[model samples]
Target: MTTFLTFTILGLVLGAVYAIAASGLVLTYNTSGIFNFAHGAQAMLGTFLYWQLTYGWGLPMWLSLIIVVGVVGPAMGAALHALIMKGLRDTADVTKIVVTVAILLGMLFLSQWIWHPEDARIMEMFFGAGAKVEFSGVVIRYHEIICLLAAAAIAVGLRVLFTRSRVGVVMRGAVDDPDLLRRCGHNPDRIAMLSWALGSTLAVLAGVLITPVGGGALEANALTLLVIDAFAAAMFGRLRSIPRTFAGAMVLGLAATYVAAYFPTDWTWAGNLRVSLPMIILFVVLIVLPQDRLRGAAIRTRERYRAPTVRKAVTSGAALVAGVFLLALLMDDTSITTFGLGMTFAIIALSLTVLTGYAGELNLAPLSFGAVATIVAFHFGITGTGLAARLTPWGVLLAVLVTAVVGGLVALPALRLRGLYLALATMAFGVFLSNMVLRDTTEHTLFGVTFSLFPNGTLIVPPLQVGPLDLRDGRTLLMTATVLFALIAIGLVALRNSGYGRRLAAMKDSPAASAMLGQNLVKLKFGVFMLSAAIAGLGGVLMASAGGSVAGDNFHIMASLSLVMLTVVGGIGYVSGALFGGLMSGVGFTIIIGTFNDLAAATPPMETIFKSLGHLAMVATALIGMGVGKNPSGMVHDLFESYRALRNARPVLIGGAAAQAVLYVLALTGVIGNWWFAVLTACLVMMLPVFGRMLAPTAVRETPLELVGVDEPYTPELRDRLDRELGLAPALGGDRHAVA
Candidate 1:
């Protein structure tokens, strides 16, 4: 009983922090209509800031707290709300999700950028270095007491504010219908702004209160995962109920603590299971949670698409093959390898196109499928498992097929889910997979029988083969990947043009409408999920085979989110989008960055500028992806549609693709003086015609708006409301009568 009480106390301290964090989540979402997935990142940032203020600047704890929670915190919240969240309210759910996630990524990198890797800092507790209260062989620190107090105070304060105050009523009104609130002559934005401010302060307070409980060590990533606990808590409240959210946080805290305490420490996988308990709960809760209860349905229009003709696809494929053959002939080994990797990523992105683009599912777990493929290949003797037996193509094909079936099964629970709930479910599954299998020393037991699926180390892979063809050479592998990509591209195009494609389109647009139209959603969902998983597995097989190994680190859950982001940025619906995404992710993230870094080092003065700019490749992709989410169709989709609309510039499109392919090959093969210089210059030159197209003047007519009379009262408040809602500048050709 003593031990139980001690552990309970220990757990409640964390529960207190979770409660604080969860409340903040509920507050912002209820008022702002933004879930703030970056909530954890924000808390991490605040904790870091507090650490910096107190330790680095040698400020008093009181002053640091004021600066962090009062000033810096609110400012960050307000700025984010104004700059990002306000725009996101009108965007699709994916856009909102990607934006917050992008913020999280941006904050992480920013933290790293500001706090250099070499410098290390530590912080002391709030009240004192060592302060505690003890009873009945149980001990609790002052910091823990502080956490409890703060959580209780915040909870009561919020309950009173929301339940008793007029401002709170207006705030609640804000999230429900901002336009309606506007009609009531109250600015919903202002109420949302306040909610964000208060919520941000709570996040900072939670971090400040909680970090010391976790040994007072301040690391950005660790602090960020603290938000995961809050996610479970917030979800328990259905992202709205404050008291329930608090209770949920406490329950989770106790549950995790008890699991840690009771689980066997000597077992091989016990630690992983303990570490993964929260994620398991998170995933299971998401699967069980009602979809309608989730907030922030993507407030955007449906995606629009036009599948290219079979002749166009075939012609394009022929051209691409000819280009690849020429490039493969001209390219150096390094260049071929890079393109090979790019093609592999492209294949994976195509899976995303199928699952997300056509099927209307926003899955963030493709990497999990890919990782399963790697394991399957290795276990079945397709790779270097020291079994020397070459099952080769048969094994790999069978493994990929199995992965697809498993993925479809895994996607079953999420099929009825949509928008943010669907995304959360996928993310949770990915995290669970990372915890259970990828990091598995799966010595888990059931009914006294041990089932150890995978060892917790790097797995090996040999050269890929199909009966007699060995694709061990870089050139051979590149060609194989190219052929595979081409075939997949053709197949995807065909699939998009088929009657199945029309069903997918219908499902994507309106599920209810599709059901009413007699479409079998379950079958469509299962087929797409299976096809998508198979495609992703194939990509992973190529990646593992080409790299000659598979490792746990290769498929972290974050990588899955990034894959989704980059794919969306490149193109969600279009095959060209996958190709572009693959090229950008593979080459732009690796080769281009490497070459640019090399160039930066060569020129000392501009090193930092170029290096930083180059490093922003991932960040830039994320920013562009937020835009893609708003558009939903993708950047490539817009680019192609723009070209097709112009008609006369169709030749320029061909020229651009050809020139890029040829020049890239020339640079890669070292045929042009210096590889780095040629690649850099070639990129700029390749964009010349595209730039000219953008700059070319065209005769256009502008639509003129005629003055429309207003029926509302001619009071100043009503006039101001009209101006604000219309987003009209003070003088945008307003009617003289209305102005008068």
Candidate 2:
């Protein structure tokens, strides 16, 4: 009974912080329709600032709290809402999620960059260490009591503010109908800004309260991810209810405490389960929650791109192969290995193009699929007395098959859900795979073999054997990855042009419209999931074979989401986008950082200015990728359009090609090293599209005299109408509809 009481007191303290974080999340989402994936990140940033102010600057606790929560937090929220999230309510849900996730990652990078720590820092208690209360053999800190009361007070206070306050009604109206709120003479932007301020403030308060709960030392990502627990609580309130969210937080806290206190400490499974308890709760709640509450009104989906012709695709493929061959000739073994990694990542990104871009379903966990493949290959490809390794081809096939089955099972449950709900479900699956399967080699007899599937740490991957050929060589791996990438690219293109692709496109455009046309969305969705899993699995097998081993950490929960972000930045609608994403994210990022670092190291002053890209490249990519929301068609698409536009100036293309040829000759003659020549050639190649555009004839949108007299379509009458309706009217009549 005394143990129970002690655990109960501890649980309440934890629950109070959760309640505060969740309430803040709910508040912003309610008013903005943006389920901020970065909510926890904002809280994390606040935590760091609070710590920095108190410890680093030697400021009083009160001053630190006031500045961190008041000035820093609100300013951060206001900047996000005003700069990133304003006018995004009607945008595609993918864009919204991506933007928030970008911010989440950006803040993580920002916090680390600023603090720049080699180790964790301590968080001071709200009150003096000795301040506490004791009753019935149970002891609780004054800070604990304070946190509990604050949670309750906020819950009750928010309830009153929402129900009885005029400002609350306006805030509610803004998200539901910003136009309506504007009609009633309330500034919707102001309401959004105010909600963000309040929301960010609450997030900071939660961060401050929870700091001591982490038991002193702080890790930024760890602190940020702890809000995964709060996600369950927020979902309990359907993302909008204050009281229910509070209640849910308390329940989770109590349950977690009880599990830790009573579970067998000797069992590794029990300990792992304790770690995964919040994920379990989140998964269960997301699965069991009423679907309608999560699904909101239709968001304006981005327009799909026109399919590139086979001739163009073939031309591009040939160019790609030729480029890779030349690149292989020029690069060192290290470059070859890095390039192979890029190709492998590209293969995985192709899966995203198909699933999220082509199918219009947001999958937040693509890496889990790859992880599945890695595990399967490791198990099947090991040689032993009882069981010899399967043939390389057969092992790879088996790995893909296993991943497909897992993906199919996951897809079956997500048929009724879409957008954010589906994303959450996939994220849950990722978390489950990471927590329960990864690093969990033990078996429970009563529960069966699924629980015993994985190993404790690194899984040894056998060498890739094809008859007499050994593919463990670096060059061999690069060629193998290139071949596999080409095959997947060809397959993706074929699929995009198939009947399934047509149906998928229709369903993506409008599920209701597709159903009316007699399309079976269930089958379409299911088949695509399997296909995507297969491609992702193949990538994983290639990656593992190259590395010679696999570990659980390689497939973290955030894997799939990060892929989406990178691919989207490159472009998601085309196979080229996947390639761009792969190269840019993997090799391009590595190469750029390497070049800069080399230059930096060569000069003493510049060395300090350019840190190893290894530390900042991925983070920089994510930060820049936030702009992808504004470029819905993606950078690849724009590049292709520019390519087509530049085709009229064949001379420019020829000139750039001639320049590259000269550089290649120079490299061969040893006038310049192949590495430097390759770099120069790459730069020249990148400039072709831009130079083509510059040399190409300026596009004249002016109608021919014969068509100028026509009404509607591209005519003045309809153009003026569209301009007026879109609030693009000129200040003066003479300025309206003037031809550019």
Candidate 3:
């Protein structure tokens, strides 16, 4: 009875903090219509700042609280609104989610860089150690009492603000009908900004309150993920209701405490289960929530995808493979290995192109599915033929099939959800996998059959071999991965250009309309998800084969988040985008930092600057992710369009190709320095379109029309000429300059 009361009190204190944090999340989402994935990151930053003020600088705790929760938090919120959130107002839900996630990553790494995670920075609980109230053999600290009171006050205050305040009503209206609010002389943007400030203040307060409850340690990832526990509470409220959110927080907090206290300590599964309680709560809540109505295709989107013809796909794919082989010739074995890893990532990213790009379903657990495949392959394929010698092709097939089945099972629960809720469901699954399965090393017995999911906390995957062709060699593996990526990419392009692909696109546009047209929305969604999972599983097998081992940390939920961000930034809708994103994210930044490190070793004077590039590279990736809002079509699309002028200018294409070939030959023959050849080749490619426009015949170039004849006769010849000039039709036999 004493232990129960003690745990109960502890639960209430934790619940109160969760209530406060979740209320802030609900507030911002309600007003701005953006579920801030970075809410936890904001809280983490506030916690660290408070610690720095009070513990590091020896400021009074009261002063630190006021600075962090009152002034700095609101200022940070307002600045985020003005800079990042404001631009996201008109973007897609995926873009908004990715941007917030990018903010989370940016802040997390920035905190680590600044605070150095190895350092011990403990914050003192409020009112010191002596301030505790003991009643009936149950000891409750003053800090716990204060937290409970603060949460109650916040709840009542927020309820009043939302129900009876003019500002709050305007804030509600901002999300429901921003144009209407604007028309009523209330600036919706200002209302959103105000809500963000208020929300941020609450988040910071929660962080400050929860720190001491969590042993007063200022750890970046721990604090951030701990705050993520509030997500279940927020979801329970359906991201709107304060009362329900509070109730849900209490339940979650009590449940976690009870499990930790009552569950058998000697049971290996109990620890992971306790850690995964919040994700379980979140998953259950999302699954039980009512299905959101299928939205109409009324929202304007900047998303564009061009389906390549079979010939074009084949040519591009062949070129890509040849290019990889050529690149291998220039790079050493180590570099080739890195490139192989990148190609595996590219294969995984191609799955995103099929799912999110064509089918328009957002998944946050692609890597989790890959992790599942890796484990399956390891257990099923290993025949005790030494650590890295065993190879089984059938095991790879089994892994893919099992992963696809698992994906289908996951999608079953998420079928009723869409947009943000669907994303949350996948995130929960990913987190659960990370905590319970990937990290678990326990041996279990079922029906008298004993097996360990991950023995020794790692899965050693053997290198693959097919028909006497050894892929253990880095160069061979690189070539094989390149070939696989090209084949998959080409096949995906063909799928995109096919009838089924059009159906997927139509379904993405409007599920209701698709259903009306007799399309099986459920089957289409299910099939695509399974296919995507299969693709991801194949990528995983390849990755494991190349690396020869796998671990839980390699496929952590955070890495999955980064993959989503980078894939979106690279262009979620295009095959080429996936390749670009996969390379940039998988190994590009690492390679950049490594290159700088090597240079630093060679040049002593620039060591500091080069060493700093590691953190800068991570931050730069986050910045790029944030920029996805501005270019929803992705960086690859922008690059393609930027160079589209070269398509019609034969002279420019010839000249550019000739120059690149010369550079390649020069570098190959050692006539010019390799670095110089690389630089010159890159410059020539980037400037090709510029040179195309500069040197092309005026008739072939795209320029603003003089608009001299708006009322001119709409003749077939005129139409043809106009179409040719607009680059929308084949050129006919005529004076090319006739249209102008």
Candidate 4:
């Protein structure tokens, strides 16, 4: 009884912090209509700031707490609202989710860069570590008591604010009907900003309280995920009710504590279960709880998906393969190998293209499916003699097929889910896999064969030999992946242009309208999920082969988030976008860092600058993702549209191609630096359209009245010009009433 009581009090302390954090999440989502994926990251940032102020800067604890929770937190939230979140209105759920995730990544890396992970940093507990009271043989710490009181105060405060206060009422109505709120002379945006500020303040409080309990270690990722425990609590209330959220937090905390206290650590599943408890609860809550109704016409995306013809896709793919082969000549073994690994990333990203791009389903765990495939391939394939020990056709087929089945099964529970809910469900599955399946080390026997996932923490792949061809060589693997990606790209293009593809697109546009039109939404989603899973699985095996090994950390949930972010940043709606994402993440960034390392090796004085730049890559990725709101269609689409200006300028295209080719040849021959060659070629490509427009301007096309807003932004000037053209503008000798 004493042990249970001790654990219960401890659980309540943990639950209180969770309740505080979750209340903030619920508040932001209720007012802004965006489920902030970065809520934990915000809390994490707050925790780090407190540490910096109190420990690093040697500020008073009270001063640091006030600066972080009272000022910094609210300011950060308000700034994020004005800069990023405010622009997300009317954007697709994917855009909102991705942008928040970008903030998460941005904050995570920024903290790491600032704190320098090598240093030992500890946050002292409030009132000192030993400040506690003994009650009937159970010891209660001061910090614990403070947390409990804070939670209670926050719970009551928020309840009263939302239920009794006019501001809270206006905030609640912000999402329901912003226009109506505006008609009532209330600024919905301002209300949302206030809610964000309040939410951030709560996040800071939660972060400050939870840090001491977590051994005072300020590990960024760990801290962020710790705050994520509040997600389960937030979802428990269906992202609204404070009281229910608090109840859920208590239940979650108690469940985790009880399992840890009573469950045998020696048991294989026990550790995983305890580690994954929050995610499991989150998944269960999402599944069992009734979901909100399908938002009718609520889905608004600026993205445009246009399927390429088979011929165009094939030609582009062939050119890409050729480009890869030529590019390999300029790279050394290690660089080429890194580039090859990126191809696998591209393949995985392509799967996202199918699921997110065409099918309109946001998957946060694309790499989890790949991890599943890698497991199957390692076991089912590579089992025979010396040459036969390599990957076999049957094993590859088995892996893909098995993963597809698994994907379909995964989708079964989440079929009714949409948008953010669906993304969370996928993320929960990925977390579970990361914590349990991928981390499993115990040997298991099936069909008289024994194997384990990441046995002893790593799964090494044998040299990849398919039939008679050995692709273990870096260049060979790169070329092989390129060909495979091309084939997949072409196939996806064909799928997009097919009748079934049309149905998927229609569903993406409006599931309700499609259902009304007799389209089977269930079948479409299922098929797309399976297809995507299969592709991801294939990419996994290839990635393992490319890198020669796989580990649990390689497919961590955070890595999956990055994969989705980079892919979306490249252009989620296009095949080239995946390819672009794959290269950027895999090859481009790797090469940039590699070049810097090479420079640092040759020039010692610049080592610090180069190292810092390499570290900045993470922050750069986040910044790029944050820009998705401005260009929702993606970078590839923008590039494509820009190049259309050069369509009539054959001489410009020829000149640009010649210049790039010459630079490539020079780099291959060691006459020019590979880095220089790459930069010059990119410059030439970007400048081609500019040169084309200057030298051979395209004919002006008349804009139809209906196409004004559809094709281009309808600005005041454009509108006024159109009105004048139609004799409706009073300033242009038209009737004032007609203009009005």
Error (Å) of candidate 1 at residue 430 is 0.9
Better candidate number, 1 or 3, judged by TM-score: 3
Off by over 4 Å in 4: 384-389, 444-451, 701-740
**CA lDDT, every model vs. true structure:** 0.76, 0.78, 0.86, 0.87
Query: Please, what are the lDDT tens digits per residue for candidate 1 over residues 635-711?
Result: 77666655543445555656666776666666666766445545665565546546546754462322111112344
Residue 614 C-alpha lDDT in model 3:
74
Residue 156's lDDT in candidate 2: 90
Report the lDDT tens digits of candidate 2 across residue range 1-740.
99999998888888888999899888998899888888888998899889888998999999998899889889989988888788465556677888888788778777777777576788867786588878998988888888999898999989988899999898898799999889999999989988898888888889888878768588787778786568878888988788999999998888878888998877767766766777788877877878763222255555346576556677777778777887788778887887888888888888888987788787777878988998887777555432333237778889999999988998887877777777777877887788778868875565454545675577667556777666666777777777777777777777777788878877776787787778888899999999998888888777776666678876776555667777877777788888887767556756866877787888878676676544476577777667766676678766766666665788987887788888887887779996688678768867887787667658433332224446325545545645654458544455544642
Range of the 10 consecutive residues with the lowest summed lDDT in candidate 1: 699-708
Ranked candidates, highest TM-score first: 3, 4, 2, 1
The 10-residue segment of model 4 with minimum total lDDT is 729-738
* Pairs in steric clash, model 2: 366-560
Q: Worst ten-residue run, lDDT, model 3? A: 699-708
TM-score of 4: 0.93
**Angstrom error at residue 454, model 2:** 4.6
Q: How do these models rank on lDDT, best leading?
A: 4, 3, 2, 1
lDDT of 4 by residue, 412-520 (tens): 8899899889999999999989988987889877799887776888877665676667877888888999999999999999998888988988887788888888988
Model 1: which residue pairs collide? 93-298, 384-462
